[model samples]
Target: MVSFIGMIKRNMLVYLKDRQAVIFSMITPIIVFVLYILFLRGTFVDALEKYLESAKGLIDEKDIDVFANMLLLSGVIGSSVITVSYSSLVTIVADRQAKIDYDISATPVTRVKIIVCYLIAAFINSFLISAILLTGGLIIVSLLGNTYLSFINVLALYGITLLGSLSATTILMILVLFFKTTNSAGAFQGLLCAAVGFIIGAYIPISQFITPIQTICNLFPGSHITALYRNVLLNGVIENMNSSMNGLDNGSLATTLKEVFSLNLNMFDNYIMVNGMLWYVIVIIIVALIAIAILFNKLYKRK
Candidate 1:
């Protein structure tokens, strides 16, 4: 256990010492937040206005802005999880490229301990980065939208963000093991960082995509993580909207907005609830962890 902890500390120190790499890991999510504020925020508000026209007379305009900001914040958290976790793979690739793994292999440490140490370090770094992003997002949303989240909602967001970070880290660990060089891992990470937002519907609403594209997004845990985050973060806003427009047939509009923003997903001709999505993410994490253990064994034998 002591050796395992030492390995984790060593890996973390290596990752943290590279200031440029740490900043690069967080850049994509920060850019997405900036773009949403500058460009997409207005577009979403304009689009939502048409659907919310009936409630305009009843609801305050500021409330609508608050709801929109909450929705965007959820997407930002989703993007942060992927970017940070994927970027954490740099530590694993660095170990291989620097032949640090070989040095560790010559010691008394078991292969499983080394692999677990790397996983633990990655999880910690990714989770810490995600937590910072989530806090910043909430603060910005509160200031910009002139609203505050409930205490329970804040706790729930932290928990969900941690889970999302874990799932991303586990899956990436498996893929990172396949790369023998830092350059190849860096290349793939760049592509993933660029495209993950679209895949998880962070850059655009999932509903705007065609059926096939939507289906592909649904297959990944990232989309479900976004859906779960939105479900919690925007629940109050949605409820207020429903109450303000009571006795009105706004069910279709409400449902459409939820689907578009990834608060829900259509699965096998039926929409899955937030609980169902949470279970799906948990299952993915379990499967990915098992795969990682198996890959670790295979690589150890080769070493």
Candidate 2:
């Protein structure tokens, strides 16, 4: 146990030694947040009006803003997953390439501990990174004077994003343990961050996608985490509401006779808090198991 603790500390210290390590995981989110605020300004209302027109409804403008906020928050939380996954992968690959991983295995370390060390180090980094990003995001919202920020909501956002980061760690470990080459690891991480990270509506709003694409987007862990953020920050809860014709267009009788039936929207209620936490636990266990398995296999390697 002492050795395990020592290994975790050592790995964390080593990770801190790299300047880029801190920037990607820690600095990049803030940079993205600033960029988003700048780019989305003066256009949010225009965009909302367009979405309202497409919804084919007489819904309240505030309701539209509320829904839009949820989508944006989800993207914000998704960005954290990118940072956690890529930065950890890069460090793990670097350690292996330098033969430090083999050196550690030569000691009295067990396979479980070897993997645990990396996870511990990653978790510590995740906690700090998630906390900072969440706080910064809330601050940005508050500064805009257009949104509310409460402690409970902030904590929920943190929990959801942390789970996403934990789940993403599994992919990072799998890449590092098997790829074994630093260049391959770097390239793979780059592709994932581009394809799976910022583009997948994790950093951008998934609501931008049509229904079919949005359905597919739900599969990504980052999407769910971002949903949690929206529920907490914007809705103050996650509820599962059945599809209702509440927001449907109610035009003049002549228009109504046209029989332009509107699509039913499924309303997810305050159940987001419960379901989101459930997802967090499930993702954590599954990712932990995968990371453990990979670490054990690598630990016993004869090289």
Candidate 3:
């Protein structure tokens, strides 16, 4: 166990020294988030207003605030998923290319220990990427004039992101173990991550896609993670609102915006938070175990 920890620590140290990797994992996510926000600012505001009226008095005066917070959190989670999968797969492939697996195999260390060390290292990378994205997101939000930040929401977002990122990384690790070749792992991981990103609405508005595609996407960890953010951010939607109805009847974006920005409380409670985070952890564990079994089989067959 101690040796495994040492291995993970060593990999982390190496990761810190890799400036290119650091930038790709940390900087790229924030940049992408900023760009995405800039491009979708209008749509976001419109959606926020429309959704606010749907909640009625159930949520008061906090639609814009909640929407902004949710957007930032979702960006952090999405970026972390990308960062973890990219780093974990690329690093493992590089190690395999260098024959590090055989070197470790020839040593006293067990394959299980080696795999655990890899996972730990990947988790560390994922965690750091998440932290950086969160901090960067907060700065962006602050600069954009959103002062009503909820630390509790931030904490929930972080927990969900961490689990989601780890889950995606674990799946990639399975691919690495199964394929063995650096080229195979790299190609598969890149393509899979891109596909998952689209399916999860990370890079595109995947939710706007057809129901069948969306249903298929739900099977992926990325989709679930993003859905958690969407649920929290867009919880208790206002549906629509008309001014003549005194905020009681739903009507349109303009009316909903007028009503939504006037609230002070959240539309949805903690239930969504509990469910979303629980789902990530449960799914991650199940996937990780299955991945380990697959890796063991591959290794056995190779031997």
Candidate 4:
């Protein structure tokens, strides 16, 4: 246990000492947030307006703005949880490149202990950053002055962020060992930055795609996690809008909006609710952790 904790501390200190790696790990989500402010926010608002074309004056425009921001915020959190976790694990690749893993293997620490320490350190670091992003997002959205996020909702957001970080850590742990050098990991991070936005429906919503494409994206735990975010953050605003409209569209608009933004996914012809998505994410984490342990034995190749 002492050696495990020491390894964790050593890994964290080395990773944190490199400011550029830390910054670039978080850069993907920040870039997505910036893009929303510059371009996508207006497009979403217009889409909502188009949806409400019949009852143009019914929905509060401020609420629409708030709703749009909720989507952007959720997408940012979703992308960050994975990107940050992956970046945190990049330290493992660097250690391998430097033959540091060889030195560590000569110690009393078991291979499992070393690997667990790597995951634990990454999880801690990723969750801390994700929590910061969540707090900042809530603050920014609150500036619109009409958000409907309750204390319970805030707690749930934190809960989802926790699960998100864990899921990302275990999932990425299996993938990280495939790269024995920092350069390969760095290149993959770039691809991940570009792909995650689409995978989680940040760049374009999963709803806009065909059924098969939607299924492909939704297969990822990150996509379901993002769906969880959409429900928690946007459901409150949606309730407010429904009250304002007084069932004006007979709940059709709310349902349509949910589908449009992927507040829920119709998988296997069944709608997946919060509890269902939670289960899915939990299952993914379990499977990923098992895979990581097995892969470490097979592929970590400590030399």
Say which candidate scores most in TM-score. 4
Give the winner by lDDT. Answer: 4
Winner on lDDT between 1 and 3 is 1
Q: Model 1, residue 264: what's the lDDT? A: 81
Candidate 2, 160-195: lDDT as tens digits? 666666766665566566666778876765566556
lDDT of 1 at 97: 83
Q: Rank the candidates by TM-score, best first.
A: 4, 1, 3, 2
Q: Give the per-residue Cα lDDT of candidate 4 at 240.
A: 83
Off by over 4 Å in 4: 301-303
Model 1: per-residue Cα lDDT over 1-303, one tens digit each: 787888898877777788877887877677777887798788778877877886778766877798778777777788888877777667877877888778888888888888888888888888887898789878877777655468998898899988998889898888898998888988997898788888777778776887778888888888888888888887777766767777586566567668667688866556788888889999999999999999988875435
TM-score of 1: 0.94
Better of 1 and 4 by lDDT: 4
TM-scores of all models?
A: 0.94, 0.73, 0.73, 0.96
Clashes of each: 0, 14, 16, 0
Model 3 Cα shift for residue 262 (angstroms): 23
TM-score of 3: 0.73
lDDT of 4 at 85: 91
The sequence of per-residue lDDT tens digits that candidate 4 reaches over residues 194-265 is: 899999998788888888888888888999999999999999988888777787678988888898888888
In candidate 4, which residue pairs clash?
none
RMSD of each: 1.7, 6.9, 6.4, 1.3
lDDT of 3: 0.58
